[model samples]
Structures are given as structure tokens and as C-alpha cells.
Target: MIGSGPGGALTAWSLAKDGHSVTLIEAGPRLRRPDFGQSIGHMLASYFWDGGARTSRGNVVFPTMQVRALGGGTVFNSAICMRPLESALERWRDEHGLTEMTSEMLDPHFDAVETFLNIKAADDDILGRRNELFREACSELGWEWEHIKRFEEGCVGSGECITGCRAGAKNSLDKRGVAEVVQAGGRVYTSVHIDQLIVEHGRVRGAVGMTVDPETYERRHPVRIHAGCTIVSAGAIGTPTILRRSGLTRPAVGSALRFHPSCYIIGVFDEEVNPWFGATQGIHATEHLEKGIKLEALWATASTFSRTLPKRPKQFKRYLKRWPNMAVWDGWVSGDASVGDVRVLPGGRPDIRWQMGDADLRRLQETNALLCEMYAAVGAKEVFTGIVGLPDVMDPREAADRLREGRFERTEMPTASNHVFGGSPMGTDEERAVCDGWGQVYGIDDLYICDTGLYPSSPGVNPQLTAMALAHRLGQELPERY
Candidate 1:
């Protein structure tokens, strides 16, 4: 297993439970509770890829927030657990020929993950003031909203879910699944890079890479491990880079990249919302999802909020002054029309090239309209659209008019995405996909990809639960062959 995110960790846990010997190799260092603190700077340095600085470009430039820790994204994500919507599964079946990835077939896997992770809906007791405002706005706007479920145990609403929770609340893979794997006799190698798979006689025998200390940047020694079967869960970016570097050059191996491109909306009310008090995010709406759009509250922290603020010192300081009154919401549209490719740079790093297609752009505008309306509906006295051409709206009626007339340009808004799906897709069609219905890579014996990269299209929602479910289904089924 070449990763430790939900897909990789869950697969490892399952395989180990089946009495299989597993060696989980992670390129990043392991940080436990002792190494963690409240500093966002330390969190980024210790957990995130490029210290949370990597960005992608094409039609629009945006930060791609991938993690580089023992547990990968499970370490820094908000722990939002959502099963794949049935509508998205239908698209995967009809368009991508993923016939068996139906909701009914994967129900057991989802149930297993939810039970293991202790997933539960956020209750009113923990929903914080920010959520109260958001829920009220959704109600007033006549949009159906729901409390988001999270993988948590003793959660105290620390509001630091994004930067690695030290409260021992969020059930990140490192604390849950990965720990179980270790308990089941699986070995883990952290801070060791896997350069490429060793293919011999059309079969994966092992992999080779060097051990480098993440703290000192010192190359220690080259290492190799031989395994009976190989699975790549290095995520959408890392997996493709590894395959291409190892000479797997099928077109689908690095194509069909998709994302739920997103922006934020901040509204200021007379009373202090103290937006940083409770759970990072516990509320969201799927009312407009058929249009490939969704809205949720952001996991706002001081460091993240400052980063999303205006570039200008004066304009930025102004927002800081009003920070107490500010309540932020997030919006995203599944980039259905926006297909992209991940290319291996000369140094083995992945370069993602993507631009929002017309559909995605329109979706963004529609999201802006909905978000602006929500803020207006909530009796916000001042609303900041986070848009360049648009000014602060003081009147709800004017906000609606401007939203309708607004011509959204890519340059005007800041965007960030944690959900990057697809690079090597899996399906029954051998020619267009790199992996089969079983997630086995074509022409590569004993090697498979078990991650969201296997997704032929974006699921348009939080994908961790879906990825875990699919990985569990395949992991349990594939061991019989081994």
C-alpha cells in the first residue's frame, strides 16, 4: 500500500484483518499528538504538501490543498463524512461504465466505515453560533439544509478540524484505521519515498526508494520491499506521478482530472458571531446539488482567513476589523465540463492543468447568487462577495441585481479545493481506463489503484466516505485472488 489516506489505510486494515502481511509505505513523516500544537504554521509545515502552498493553473489558478502526513488528507480535512449521492453513482454507471459502483452494492461498505469511524450527525448542542446563523438563512431562503455528519468520538467543537485535531475527537485514519492495521501486525514505514514499482515479467515484485529524514532533509539509505500484491493509493496527484515515472504511459493514467471548484462568502451581522467558536463545519445544503452545486460553512481559522483575505494591506485590514461580525460560507460546483490532465514534471512532481469549462463557470455564478441571497436573507447588514468586480452589498435587493448582472471572470475570485478526483480511472472499458472494474491496472499483474483517482468523474460532494467504501469493497474482494 503506497499511501495512508482513507483509501490506503482502510485497504491496509482490511487486508491485515484477512491475515495478509501488509507493508504501508508513506512518503511523509508521522506526527502524533505529541508533535502537534495549535500553531497553523507548524500544522502546515508538519502535515500539508508544499506547506499548503501548492497551486494549480489553466483557465483559473487555485490552491490545491493536498496533505503530506502519515494519514494524508485524513489528518487535515474537516472529517466530513458523506456517502456518494445516488445521482453521481448513476452518472458513473451510465457515462463511465462503472456498472457495479451502485449505492445498493456499496451499502455494506459504507455502513462498516461509518460504524468504525463513529460517524454521526452534528446536533444542536455542538452546532455553534455560526451554524445557527447558516441554518436560519437556509430556512428563510426555503432551501433544505442538513447537519453534516463527522467521524468523531469525544468532539468538543474545538474549531480546529482543518489543521489536525489534537483534541482526539476527529477519527483521522492515523488514529483509527492505521492504528488498527498496526495492531493487526501490519508494518508502517513513514518518511520514506517510493520512487517506482519494480515490474518483472509483467508483475509487480516490489518497489524502491530512499529514506530521507523530513526534518533534516538528509538522504539516509536506499530501500526496497517485495510484496505479493501492490496497490497504489498515493492519491490523484502522487499515484499518477509514480505510474508515469515507472513508464505506465496510457492516456487515462494521467487524464480525466476533476474537482469541485469553490469560493467563499462572508457576511457581517450587528452581533458578533465569533465564527471561530465551534465545530469547523457541521452544516451544509444539497438543495441545489442537481445543478452540480453545494453550500457549506468554512472551517475558518485565523491563518486560513488571513490567506483568503484581499491582497491589498488596506482592504485586508478592513476585513480584519470586521472579523468579529463576519460569518463565512463555502460553495462548490462539480467540474463536470472541466476535464484536466496531470502531467509528471521533469523532477517527478505532478503538474495539474485545468480550467473551468463554461458549465462550471456558470455554476460558479449561480453559486454566487445563492450565497449572496443567503447572506441577504440572514439579515446581514454588510456582505462581502469575495469577488473582485463586485463591491460590498448593503441592500438585499441590490445584491440580487448585481448577482444577476455579474460577469464572473476567473481572475476576480480566490479559489481553493481539497477534493481532487481522477487521474487513473477504473472501468470495464479496457481502452479508455487504466484499471478494470476490480481496480486492477491493465497489463500490470498484481498491481491495482484503490483511491478516488479511480473515480471517472467528480462525486460533487465530500468523497472520503465514498472512497473508503469503494476501497473496502475491492480490498475484501481482491484478497480471494491472492
Candidate 2:
């Protein structure tokens, strides 16, 4: 195991439980309560990569956020556990030649993961004021929405989903996969960085990397180790970087990066609607998927809310005055047209180049405009859309016109994605993809990649469930000869 995230930890646990020796290496240490402070800067230093890592193309830098600590992004993510929609699975099978993705093949794995992780519906009591307002607004507009499925077991609703859970109720593989692997005699090494894969005669031999000294902050230079098989679970970005550094070049090394670009709608109400008292990603509108949009409620801290307020001093004052009456909602684009690339940089850092296209940009604008209208329908005194060149509360006619006529280019769009896909992608043809249906690298023996990178395309939903399902299926099919 070359990473300690959900994919890596789960892979190690599965292999070790099957009576295999495994050594899990993590570049960062296990995140503790002190490391997950209220300060974003402190949290970034401890869990994130240099205030959030970025990939550059020419002069424009595209920012991507990933958790570098143990448990990976799940440590700081809102615990929204949704399986990939059936429509997406059918599309993969009918259109993408992924015939094995049928429900018959997937349901058993889903059941296993859900049972192991304890997936359930979010409690309505913990649904914050924003959720109440959102439901009311959706009802008024005759829109269909659903409460989110969460992976938390007895969540106390501290509303600190972005920060590492102090309650330890969030089941993001740390308490499940990591615990199982460790208990089964597998070793997990923290603060270890892998530099390259050791490939010998078209087979994965092992890997070499360094272990870091926490107190001195110095690396001991990664030591080499041999294994019969090597699985690349370092995530979409990390896995591709490792492969590229090791001189493994396939046509689809780092291509087809898709991100569900999202924007927030801030609604100012008359009554206190503290959104920070519930699941961060609970309550979403999936009805708009056919229309290329999805709406969801979000919880944010005061600092994050303050940062998103208008820059003008007067606007800032107004925002603070109505802080207690504010609620945040999310709008996500559904089209799979945008493209981003992940490449290895000069200093061995992973570089990403992401930008949206005209159609996708237009859809995002439309979605944000619709959210603003929905907020107004729900008796919001004022609606704030984070889109440029649009009024805070434009009328329906004005909103439509502004959204359609907006000249904002793809590069000008505000974008950031925690959900990443492609790179070592899976497809029928080896020439078009790095991995096959079994997640085996086309040309290498004893080398498998069981992670989000195997996603053929963005499923327009949380990738964790699909990732785990695929990993389970792959593990079940591991070659006996190995």
C-alpha cells in the first residue's frame, strides 16, 4: 500500500485479510485533534499540501485540494455516502463496454461495504436551519429533493465535517479499513514518501521511498522493498505522478480529468438559520440531473462564510449584520464536457491543468441563477450568487438574460474539485487506457490499480462508493498464481 486513504487502506485490509503480508506507507502522519484546528491555515499545514496544492499550465494555476494525512480526503469531507446512480451504471455498461458494472455484480460489494462502514440516512434533528429553508423553498417551487445518505455512525452533529472528526463517528476507512488491516498484522508506516515503482521485465517488483523524521522534519531516503504484486492506490493525482516518474508512459497517462464544477448560493433570511448544526452535505435535489444541475445544502464556518462575502467594505458590513440569518446552498453542473490534465512537474510535484468549456460554463450560470430564484421563492430577503457580472438578486428575466449573455470564459470560472477521476483510466482497448476491466495495467504483470483513477468518466456523484465497490470486485478476482 502506497497511500493511507480509503482506497489504499481498504486495499491493504482486503489483501491482508486474505492472508497476504502488506506494508502501508503514508507520506503524512495520522491526523489528530490538535492538527485539525479551527484555523484553515493550521489545518492546511497539517493535513493539506502547502495551503492546497495546484497544477499549472503556462501561467494559469489550477488549484486542487487533497488530504495528505492518514485517511486522506475522507478525514475532512462531509460524510455523504451515495452510490453511483443506476443511470450512470447503465451508461457505463451500455456505452463504455463496462459490462461487469451491472447491479448483480455490484450489489453484494455495496452490501458488504455498507455493512462494514455502517451507512444510513442522516438524522433530521441535526438538519440545520438551512435545510428547513431549503425544503420549504423546494416545496414552494414544486421541485423534488431528497435527504442525503450519510456514513456516520451516531454522529453528534458537531458540524465540523471539514475538520477531522473529534467525535470519531465518521466512518471514512480510518476506523474500518485501517483498523482491520492493523489488527490483522499488517504494518502501516506514516510519514513515508514513495519516489518510484521498481519495474523489472514487464512486471512490478516493488517500490522505493523515504521515511521522514517527524521531530527533525528530515527524510531518511526511501528504502527499497520487494513484493510479489504492487497495487497503486495513491489516488488519481498521486498514482499518475508515481507512474510518470517511474517512466511508465501510456497514451492515457494523465488525461480526461473531469470535475463537477460547483458554486454556492447564499440566502439572507429574517430568522436565524445557522447551517452549521447538521451534516454538511445533507439534503440535495437530484431531480435536476436530467436538466444538468443538482442542488444541495452546505454547512460552513464563520470564517469561510466571511471570505465569500462581497469585497466592498459596505457589503462586508451588511453581510456581518445578517450573518445569523444566512444559509448556504450548492449548485453543481452535470455535463461531462470539461477537461483537465494531471502531469508530473519539474520538481516531482503533480501539476494539473483544468478549465471548463462554454457549454458547461453556461450550465453552471443557469444553475446558480435558478438557485437564487429558489431562495427568493422561499422568502429570502436577499439572494447572493457568487457569479461575476450578475446582480445579487436579479429578477427571473434578468437572471436568464445575464446567465445566457455572460461572456465569462472557462478560465474565469471559480472552480475547485475534491472529486477527481481518470488517469490510469479503465477501458476495453489498451491503446486508449492504462488499465483493463480488471484494473490490471495492460502491459505489466502483478501490477494493479484499484482506486478512483479507474473511473471511466465522472459519475456526477460521490466517487467513494463506486471506488470501494470496484476495489472489492477487483480483490475478489486477484490472480491465484500471484
On the 0 to 100 scale, the lDDT of residue 103 in model 2 is 82
| Alpha-carbon runs more than 4 Å astray in model 1 | 216-218, 307-319, 392-397
Candidate 2 lDDT, tens digit per residue, 82-107? Answer: 78877777777776677888888889
Write down the RMSD of all candidates, one decimal each: 1.7, 2.3
lDDT of 1: 0.82
User: Model 2: residues >4 Å from true position, as ranges?
Assistant: 53-61, 213-218, 392-401, 404-407, 479-481
Residue 182 of model 1: what lDDT?
A: 92
* Cα lDDT computed for each candidate against the true fold: 0.82, 0.74
Best candidate per lDDT, number?
Answer: 1
lDDT of 1 by residue, 434-458 (tens): 8986789998899988888888887
